[model samples]
Structure formats: structure tokens, C-alpha cells
Target: MIHEKFTKDSIISLSNLTVIKEIDDYTIGDEQKNIFFRVPREAVYVIEEAEGHNTIEEIQNSILQNKKIEIDVLDFMNTLNNLGVINNISLNEGHRNNFIKNLGKLLFNKTTVIFYIINILLTIILLISFPNKLTPNYQDTFVLSSIGLSLLLFFFVSWFLVFVHEGAHYLAVSATGKKMNFQLSIRWFWVVIEANMNTLWSISREKRYIPFLAGFFIDILIINVSFILILIINDIFVISLLKMVALIQFYKIIWQFIIFLRTDFYYVLLNYFGVSTLTKGSISYLLRKISSKYSLFFDQLSIREQIICKRYSWLYVISLFAICYLFLFFSIPTVFHTLKTTLNILSAFAYNTFEFWDSFIVIALIFFEFILWIIAAYKRFKRGD
Candidate 1:
């Protein structure tokens, strides 16, 4: 009856996972290789209709007014969960405003040359004291144990780096006689330390670039130093930690391709495009313009997005779909793999005390992403035409 019920079962899961349907909401589209159930757009409408009082049969029968739901109804329900678009509870409006408000509050500091020097010394000492601290192969070692240690190392070190990076932002703002507030923000499970220095409007682009680039600078310096240590050190602990840090730096570069995420990379692209929050806002602005003379939907849209829909609807729509797919499969894995790898290292360090929690945190992060996605999409939909 319930969607979670279907996930708990076997046959229903394997048989009809994703329901592809026509844009018109009647014809059943092609089914891709179904790893999990993907709800149809039609089902989304039905679910909305059935939110509280409507029965499944009634909803299904309604959708089938002219055409039937060829896939299993329960399967469709489970698919909603898989796609992360549906849930038992009414979805909470995501923290879109919090994100914008966080701009000034989200600045972070970076590691200076001195920090790198100390890190190098520590790595050298560790390598010298124990040249052959063997860690278990992932295959031979228990999955839970390996995963657990990996998580612990990742959590601590990752947090440490974030703190240092964010701290640099805070200090920079402070030096200018401006104060900031900090928060742990998530952009789809990629942990970001955000510091708001909203008062930094008068700050020069050069000053702004320093705080933005500081984190990666520290990460790059640390990573290269790790590579130097790796040239001699035979220990898994030392090598893995360094590798993890380097990998994180590499992962952040995805921000370049995305043209969003409010990273330095994104800022570069936005400036080039002559837009703020360029990608998401573009399509909606276009849509509003195209539809204003034709569709009432455009009339009801938010003023900002209405402007976007008018200005760049066609381009915006294409980019929207393109970026969404890119973010989901590519960006998601890149971050998770880093998180997973980091966790594996930490688990090794901690002897895997909280394996369950490690898995939970990872999964929780994955779920949290959809909310951000919604906020972004909503903003795009509401951008000035």
C-alpha cells in the first residue's frame, strides 16, 4: 500500500522500477535498465491529487481516464522514493533564502605556507617512524570495518580542512573591521563551510578572490606536499590521508563545469556570462517572456523568474535539463566517492566504531541533495523574465 513497502520487497522492485511516460502524460515511454523505480510525471500528479483523501484506485482510475498506467501502481509509488521526488510527509521548503543569506556568513580561511610546513613535518615524522604501517586490502578486510575507518578519517580531516579554510575567510573579513557568522551548509552532501561577510560589498574583487581561492590553495599545497611525502613513505595511513585531501581538491573543480554552486569557478563563469546565478535563472527568464503573451502560467510566475523566462527561456530550459542530469549522476558520485573514500580512511583510523552511522551519514547526504535541487529549480522557475 505504502511506497516504502515496495522498496522492502524484491520482485516488484526488479520488475518495473522506472515508469517512463509521454510528456502528454498518457502514453508509456520506453523503460531504461531499471536499477530502481522512477516515478512518472503522471504519477506525480496523481500523488498530488491523492495527498490526503483520494484513494490509489481513484487516482489511478483518474490518470487512466483516456490512457492507463501500464506499470504497477505500487511500483510507481516506490519509483517516487527512488527518484527522491515523493515522500510520506509533505516536503519541507528547502533553505534557499538561508543559502543567499549565508553568502557573507559563509566565508572560510585557508592554510598558510606555515600550515603546510607543519603538515609536511608531521607526514615526514610519521613516515619515518613507521615506514610500513600496513592497512588491509579493501577486498580482504571486512567491508564494514574498512568503510568505518575510512569514514572516521574523512570526517575529522575534512572537517579540519573546512575549519581552516573558513577560518581564513572569517579573519580576512575581521581584518577589514567587518564581522561574519559561519554555518555548516550542504550543497547535495558536499560539506561546505559558509561565512557571511555581507558587509564586504565595498571590498575589492582582489580581496574577495583571496577568501574564495584560499581553501583550494591550502588543499593544493597540502596535496602536493603529500605527494612529496608519498615518494618515500610506505605507510597506508600517510598515503591514504594525502590521497584523500588531493582527491577533494580535484572534486571541487566540478564547480567549474557547473557554473553554479557559488564557488570561485562558478563566479568566473557567471562573470563571463554577465549574470548572477546564471544557469538556473537563465531558462526561467526565457520561459516567462515566451509564454507571457501565450500562457497564463507565465503571468503567475515570480517577478525575477518572469524576467528570466522572458529573456532566455529556450536556452535556459535546455541547460536546465542538461545540468540536472549532470549534477545527479556525475556530480553526486564525485562527491560521494570522496566522502566514501574519506570515510574508509577514517574508519581504518578509528577501528570502525560507527559503521552504521557512517552509512547513515552518507545516505542522509544523498537524500539531502534533492531539497537543494528543488530550491535551485524553483529559483530558476521564478527568475525574472
Candidate 2:
């Protein structure tokens, strides 16, 4: 029988998935799959033995004599071949190469990096020296407009900034000369900009930091540019709008600290620590202490996983509380306050009056966020992840 061989790029890494031990993990990038898979230790040895120099009988006989175990060489070779590890076919290798090459052309060089640092420093100085002037008056955005118009403006500006943020991330990834997969999806209330981060392993640890943070930098850039525009534009309406956008950007920056949301900062911390599954593993570690089911599965984790869990469990708890605090203190209160106040104002006007309709629209928009949370929760429940 013909013997299949491991590709030259096929690498066997000792992966620590559980708290107890290391396991064989395979990375076969030559086929352009760009995925890692855990495999049985014996399977790894079998692939190693199948170097194509030995026939199936010769390989199996050698293993049996050395380890005294029965083996099926054909099935094993077929399994590895099926997994794309043997590189039997060329799959998008050219596309992947071209993408990285093109991305190299768009990356920010050393000069641009210096400029970014200077820009951020200036923004900090300006914000410190003139907080009141730079601060946004959210009231100007909603109080002066009809409910419908305010909602439209808010969404337009918010989405515009969001796109720019994602674009910054795209450029950051490209700068590293790596392939990235970017997609737009809505999960419950927020439009999420999802970027596939599997290939992050291929880049240097320091370089990975920029892609995670590029979005926030882009946000700061926009805020600074808007500040300059604010100085030049005399129109009160345009000035107010810019201030509002700037305010929202400020809020988003603070929102990064709420780690339970798995914001950009969370990823940065995870990358810095060199852990793959911090939150999930930490939560599972906590769960294992309370239940047998959790323990049974958790016991399978490697030592690295256990360490990640122990190290991050406190953070997980703090982030959980932070999420609750924000929800209860901010989200719940704001929605209720807005709804109650709007209803009272509407009661003072006839239902057919513009004042009543305006108030009604505000209430609807407020509830939109709550509706999104409900939808997202329901989705998670159904998927059982």
C-alpha cells in the first residue's frame, strides 16, 4: 500500500488544553487551511513514521516490535490525509500569499507609527487642558431635534465611526503582512465587526498588540480631526454634532474597560498574557469547583489552561460585576428615566400633537437596546454555547 507523508510545513506542537497535561497539536499551513487540531499522541508518532520510505507493513511491524501494540497503518494515513495535513491538494495557497503581499503595501511603516504616538500624546494634552470645551453636550443632539431625526442622526454618526474603527483594524492587520478575515454581523443590539484572528499566532507578540488597538487609535484620530474642524466651522449645528460624536467616542473609550463585554482591551490583555481561551477557561475552572460535571471535563484541560484560569479568575469575577453594575446603574436606569420622563411629557400633550409623537419616538428608541439584549440572550440559549 502507498504511504502518505507529512508535509514539510506540518508542525507538531505540544498544546496544553487542560490543566493536567500537554497533548499533540498539529498545524499544517502549507495547505492554506490555517487551522490547528489536537490529535492523539500515538497518531502523531504514526504520521512521523509514515515518511514514505517505509511500506505500511514495515511501519506497523516496527511500531509493534518497539511498543508491542496492534496498528492499522492504512486508516491512520487516510485520516491524516483527509485532515489536509499531508498536503495532497493545493487549496488557496496563492490567494493567501497574494493577500499578505498586498496587505504589506498598506501597512504603516516606522514613520507612521511615530506620527500616531505623537497624535495620541497631543490628544491627551488637549483633553486635559480643556475638558469642558472638548466634552460633548448629548442634550444638544436630542433636545433640539424631533425624535425621528435624532435617532437617524445618532445611528448615522455611530455607524460611520464604527466603520472607520473596523477599517483601522483592517489596516493594522495588513500592516503586519498577514491574512485577515473581516465580516460585519449584528448580534442582538450591536453591529459587531468580526475579524478572524486565527492567524494571529503567526505574527510576533508585540506586533499583535496594534491590530487589537488600532480601532481605538482610529477613534482618537477622528476626535482630533473633528476638534480641528470645530475650530474652523462657525455653524452652531455642525459644531454641536461634532461635539456629540466626540462625546460618544469618549464613552466608547471608557466602555473598553468593561471587560465582560470582551472588548478590544480584553483581547489585548489576553494576547499580552499569551493565553488562548482566558474567559471560557476561567469560568469553567470556577464551575468545576462546584459541580462534578464541570470537574469531569475540566480535568481534561492541560496545565497551561489551569494556570490561565487561576490567573484570570479574579478578573472574570470583576468583569462580571462590572457588567452587572453597568447594566443596573447605567443601562436600566437610563432607559427607565427616559421612558418615564418622556411618558409624563407626552401626557401633557394631545396624542395627535407633534410633542406627543416626539416623546413616543424617544421611548421606542430607548427600548430598542433592551430588545436587542433579549434577542441575543435567546440566540445563545438556542445555540447552547
Candidate 3:
């Protein structure tokens, strides 16, 4: 939900924005930094980009005029959406109705909440109906229809989880009385609400991780309950549940090991290293470790991490490059794979809706990824990283 035109050090000054006109769901504004808008802290980075005084037309043009949304861009937008981020809007009252400015924020917030509630419900329903709905086989047409209907019902569910994820961050930081900006994010393909309080760098790591991690912990809790529900409902509705389209809801839960795609696993790795940032430094360390000359730097590292770094440093580098390249160079295959799965889900209205191939491909890819992960984990584990 966040937008930006990255042109150097532009910072939006709210005073400069004037609602030039309004048309239906859209509003036109003159861009400038003078008029500071009250955005959730997370969205300020994009807001920072709006400082160059490009008109609304220019912003829209950037999106529409472009052809393919490249992997870097997709990643950027995805990051904006999925990570806790916010959008900056014209803040001054005179520019437009004061309450109206809040419209976007309110709508986005509600969207996030609704997503979480639905995920909880659907995940639970799918589980109790387990292996039946989620399995690779179902022969009846009527059962297939039921499953298709279930998926249709749950198709638009996800952003709510993101909102909770971000809201936890907002509340966590707010609890410490830290000032934060609210922003929505689109990390990869997911939309999220975010609280911007990087300023909390001054806070201890535990405090920071509490806010950073609250969302995933909650997700794990939901997954566990869903697993229990699968057991509870197994005897009564296993076959019927299979007929329902809500199966495969637990795949994400099952494949947590793939641990790519900037999920909580990434956070766990970063936390393990005690590094505040990973995207930059991890890469640097990876590049340097290739040379024996940097062995001294590795030696200088803390006993625990030095061993980890020295051992899996190559894995760290490869993983970083792989993610970036998978996103950029292999964008076509990635998008194609995503689209193929989407179509398969859509076809559930007619087909069996269960296939060995479906879970196999996804889970297999993750498994392969884990095999590589073992290489890194082995070094870390052996060295106590």
C-alpha cells in the first residue's frame, strides 16, 4: 500500500501538499515537503520519497508506465506491503476534511484485522477436516464442489494476519512509550501493517525482538491449535472435510524449514548472530569470508559466532545471493510457479482439488532447500554457532 519515487534524499514536507482535486476514490495533491503528513512511522520511508514534488500523475505513471514488475521491484513492493510499514497522507486539516485523511488508514487497519480472523477460522476448519481435504485424493464430484466452495470463501484471507503481525509491533514499541509511525507494507506478495520504531535500536535486543517476533509466535500458536482441531475433527468429518476445499491450509505450517522468503526464520538467524541488521552485513561478511585473509576477522569474532561465521559463512553468502537471484534472475520461473499454483487452486471448482503433485512440488522444494540448510546448520551446530 506504500508508494515511492526513489530520487535521492527527498523528504515529504506535509505543508507543501495541497489536495488539488478529488475524483471518486482518488485525490490529487501538489507534492512537496512543506506540508508534513501524519503517517504511521513505518511508511515514512516512502513518504520520504514523495519529497521530490512529483505530481500524483507522475506517481501513477511510474506504476502504469512500467512493464514487468521486476524481481527487485516485486521484492521492494512486497517488502513494503508485508513488512510493518505505513503510508503518509496529507496531514493538515485545511487541505481536506480532517477525518477523511484517516479513511485510508482505517480501511487498511480493518482489512488487516479481518484477514487474521479469517485465517484463524479457515486454518482451523481445514485441519479438523485434515488429510481428507488436504490429502492428494478425492473421487467424488460433489466433494470436490464443496472443497472448491471452501477455498472461494477463504480466497481473500491473509492481510489480517499481516495487520496483527504489524499491530503487535506497534503495541510492543508503544508499550515502552516509543513514538512510532504507522505504515502498511507489501513484502514480496503479502500486505502488512507496520510500526516504525527503528529508533528503538537504543533498546536491548530482547525488547526489540519481542516486538519483532510477537506476530510469528502468535502464528505458531494458531498453527498448533489448527493441528489439534485436525485431530478432533478427524473421526467425524474426515472424508467430508476432504471434500471441502479448505485442505492444504497447513502446508505453510509444515514447511517452516524452507525458511526462505524473509519469514520468521530469517529473524531467528539474525537474532542468533546478535546483529541488528542482516540484509547488508550478512552479505558483506559472506563476501569477505571467501578469502583466507579474512580468517583473522573470523577469529576475532565472539567464540560462539566466530565458529558459526567461519563455518557457514559460505552458506550465508550463497543463501543471500540465491534469494536475490531467485527473485531477480529467476523471476519468470518464480512467477510462473506462483501463477500455476493459483490456477490449480482455482480449478478446484471442477477437479479433485487434491493431488500428490501439488504438495509434493512445494514441500519438495522446501525440503531441498532444507538439505542445503543442513550444510550451514551443520557447521553452526558443530561449532556451536
Considering every candidate listed, which one attains the maximal lDDT?
2
lDDT value for model 1: 0.47
For candidate 1, what is the TM-score? 0.41
- For model 1, where is the 10-residue window of minimal lDDT? 27-36
Q: Once superposed on the true structure, which residue ranges of model 3 sit more than 4 Å away at CA? A: 1-152, 179-195, 234-278, 288-385
How well does each candidate superpose onto the true structure, as a TM-score? 0.41, 0.67, 0.38
Estimate every model's Cα lDDT from 0 to 1: 0.47, 0.62, 0.42
249-281 in candidate 1: lDDT tens per residue? 434433434433555554433323333334545
Ranking by lDDT: 2, 1, 3
Candidate 3 lDDT, 75-168, residue by residue in tens:
3334433432323554332333334334323423434556656666765565567655343221221232333333332233333444655565
Which candidate, 1 or 2, would have the higher TM-score against the true structure? 2
Question: How would the candidate models be sorted by TM-score, starting from the highest?
Answer: 2, 1, 3
Per-prediction CA RMSD (Å): 20.3, 6.8, 17.6
Residue 139 in model 2: lDDT: 55
